[model samples]
Target: MSPLADRYGRRFPYLRLSVIPACNFRCTYCLPQGYHANPNAAQALTLDEIARLLRGFTVMGMHKLRITGGEPSVRHDLTYILRTAAAVPGVTKLAMTTNGSLLTRRLHEWMDAGLNAINVSVDSLDRAKFARITGHDRLDDILHGVDLALDAQMPSVKLNAVLLRDVNDNELPAWLEYLRERRVGVRFIELMQTGDNLPFFRDHHVRATALETQLLEGGWQALARVADAGPAREYRHPDYAGRIGIIAPYSKDFCSGCNRLRVTATGDLRLCLFGDFGIPLRQFLQADDQIEDLVHAIGRQIDRKEQGHFLHEGRTGITPHLASTGG
Candidate 1:
């Protein structure tokens, strides 16, 4: 029962499980026209399958489990999934990333079901700009949802903004002001170059280094990171109550500290976010006693994991957009 590690000596203690691949938001950088169900794609994992997968991951030394989706709120049984993951003996952290559109109505349900941490996608603070990017006029409601999350004392209330060049890039000043009074952490992620977003990526992708420069100039100090933490490099400011994180995927040696693995909604174990292929796990996920085979298959497949992804070479393998793997 050794830990889940690649040949490069990196151990994975985190897993991002995509519960569903269908989202309602038409974020320009991701699903521009919203999600259309693919007739040929396998149906999303059932609740029991999810429980088995969680158990397998826990046995392999995964301490944190993130329930991701095209947007998790789109799933009717998300709360039940959360409860099942919470019931897993080795799962110390239970989190989910959402679009925040349904946070107002579902936040409490998620918490009662054992969700302690949450990340909501809030690409822009400006209502109109948010609408322009997401094709949804729900910024007001989303922001309100954030406030409710904080007031209810959710252990974590971080926000994710896919920084765009000419779009919401210069809104750092507004973001700092918002973070000044709240205890939330706002992460400005550099928009990645996906197969479908090459043109759009060219037009709007912002380098996270540029944002990091702004943060340093504003007296923000980089904080030390733990082994199991996500890829984001966090910074703190003495003058603000909240923190800021920069997820610079393009940064040099960004993949050196890779600690998380992903599973597609259909039960494919994806070694890397932009990996060339996936190992089908659904066959073993069909029965309760199949957990051993599931773990063994995972072990064999992960041995072939590359040292790092070839994203810098302009190769994004099978990922057409962030929504495909719950990025």
Candidate 2:
């Protein structure tokens, strides 16, 4: 099968699949107050349907799969989903992004199911501040889960921190010190204005360049670029073994090298994070007799993918909530 390439000639080998959109946390940036589940929650793809979709994507040269959600760990069939996705013929890497609140209890189970990479979203290390940010007091649980992932010796265990000015930005140095001692890779992501986070984003969005400047002033050295499939620009400090990365989606716009696609929990293939357009794959999967048609549909979506997102231009379309799209 041919590689899935967009009109810009960028090939997509990574697929981000959102299994469930119901989250336990109401992070101010991701799931602000009053956020509700999609009215079509009942239409979420079943385990078998998800598996078939994975197989279809794999056949089209998607080798890396990242299971995501409002909280993938909250899904009852998470283990089954992991096993099924990892078992797909062409899938070379199986990963997950979670809140890490429930990971301590199931870290080993997830590893047993062939999980290779893990990214935990931990915005603040301060207990009280964390509670305020996530609307939950589960920082202890999330920290324990991170420890377990490190002990399990997974190929990759990354801490994803979204930088919010005046919110958690003050914790940057502390977070670096904490991660440095633990030797875990940490990526600082700039707040994006997609979805309903526009109001919050305007108030909290911090440019990665500013953060990088701060790090440099604090004696952190810019290291050689690491070969990563994602968009983060990596850096390292001579005294710390852990690496640091900055994802400036809005400020830097790394869309030229984008190599990923996203699937909503309801089986819609999203070509761009900031774009509202998508092609529904649920009906085709339900029929189960149109493999070729599924591939063609996917190709059409790829062809329609925009050259890049328009957040820099102050044009954020009516995108689904971050939870629904598994950001």
Candidate 3:
């Protein structure tokens, strides 16, 4: 199979697959008002369907797969899905992004099933602040989960935090101090203007570049860029064991090197995060005879991938909820 390349000649090797859209936490930045799962959960792709889609993607040169969701762990058949995905012929790596509330119980099982790495979202380390931010008091559990992932000796365990101004932004120094001795890498992501979070984003969005400046001033050295660093610019401090990364989606347009495609839990193949364009793959997958057609359709969508998202230009397209898109 030929490598999947967009119009701009960027080859895609990563696929972000959202297995579920219902989360257990209502993080203020993501789901401030909370969410209710669709009553007809049957509308979602079955475990077998997910496996088939993953196999197709791997065949198309997608070597890196990241399982995501409103919270992927909430799915009852996640283990089965992970095991199936891990067995795909061409898949080189399997990772997951979770809220970490449930990792303490399932991290070991997931690791055993071939999960290569994990990125846990933790906005605040302060117990009370965590509860207020996520509408749940699971900070201790999340921290324990991170420790467990490190203890399990996973190749890479990262903590992903969305930087919110006047919220957890002030905790950067403290968070850095906490990670100084830990082995896990931490990434600070700038809040994106997607879905209903736009209003909240407008008020709390902090430019990751600003934070990076602060880190530089504080004595962190900019590291050489990894060829496949994705959207984050990584840095390191001589005194700290862990590395730091900053994702400036809104402030810095890192689209030229974008190498990923997203598949929503319901099987929509999104060409870009800030754009509404997508191919409804769920309908095609429902028909057994549509496998060939699905493959062709996926190729078409990849070819149509936009030059870049225009959120930085203040132009909003059909931005879906971050939960639905599994950011």
> What do the candidate models score in CA lDDT, each in turn?
0.92, 0.83, 0.83
Q: How many backbone clashes are present in model 3?
A: 0
Write the candidate numbers in order of decreasing lDDT. Answer: 1, 2, 3
Give the TM-scores of the predictions, in the order they appear: 0.98, 0.94, 0.94
Q: Write the per-residue lDDT of candidate 3 for residues 78-181, one digit (tens) a residue.
A: 99888988988888789999999778889889988889889998888889988999999999989998998888899989998888898889888788888789
Tell me the tens digit of each residue's lDDT in model 2 across 95-158: 8999898798899999999999999998889999889988999999998888888888888888
- Per-residue C-alpha lDDT of model 1 across residues 188-293, encoded as one tens digit per residue: 8998988898999888877888788888998999999998888999999999999999999899988899999999999999999998898899998889999999
Better of 1 and 3 by TM-score: 1
Worst 10 residues of 1 by lDDT: 302-311
lDDT of 3: 0.83
lDDT of 2 at 205: 85
Model 2 spans with C-alpha error above 4 angstroms: 39-41, 217-228, 287-289
Number of the top lDDT candidate? 1
Candidate number that wins on lDDT, 1 or 3: 1
lDDT of 2 at 116: 93
